[model samples]
Target: MSTSRHLSAHIDRPVREVYEYAADPLNTPKWAAGLAGSIEQVDGQWVADSPMGRITITFAERNQYGVLDHDVTLPSGETVHNPMRVLPDGDGAEIVFTVRQRAGMTDDDFARDADAVQADLHTLKQLLER
Candidate 1:
């Protein structure tokens, strides 16, 4: 089993609003720094450029439960499952992302991934709040 970290950011917006905005993959690069600045739909799949080369991003079906899970297919054909959520936090919203440490990753690598997830969530918060 791998280690996991749950990173989140609180956004000054309603859960429905945040869910509507973040549910669209086209809006990803605007806040998701881990992905390239652009993404596109090709043959019904969201494709983007990544540090490891071209990749495919597949998100969970839209739902009322605020689940934003997704799977990222790497160039090597390995797919990583990412579970996320936009939860109600009083009048605001809390966006949560689960980061898991893959096999062969060191403690520093896992920490970096957690940091990146936190930063990405923060960006999402800033965008939605504005």
Candidate 2:
């Protein structure tokens, strides 16, 4: 059994612009402060210093459909896949992030994860709309 929560934000920008910005791991530290402390490219792979220690960020291949799926490899050798996207919505764009509940996580912890995802999306909206 898998459980996930979807959080989204409407950004006043084109889908391409929003997707490009968000898909770039280098820019994660700006909006995803809670997730990424610093990001650097090591051997062509994006790595970041996070609360969980150094993690590798693997992104999907560049595409026209605004798919931004990625996997985060934790220091414990655990890899978590995150599904994300920037979709065209009227004149602007809608960014969506899927938060998956880890095994054995309490309900309160899952709620907090949702809240965190929402907060990060809000930050992304503000940063892009500026």
Best by TM-score: 1
Model 2 agreement with the true structure over 7-58: per-residue lDDT tens digits: 8999999889999999888889999865788999999999999867999999
Clash count, one per candidate: 0, 0
Q: Every model's Cα RMSD, please?
A: 0.9, 1.1
Per-model TM against the reference: 0.96, 0.94
lDDT score, candidate 1, position 10: 89
Residue pairs of candidate 1 with colliding backbone atoms = none
Report lDDT (CA) for all predictions.
0.89, 0.90
Candidate 2: list runs displaced more than 4 Å. none
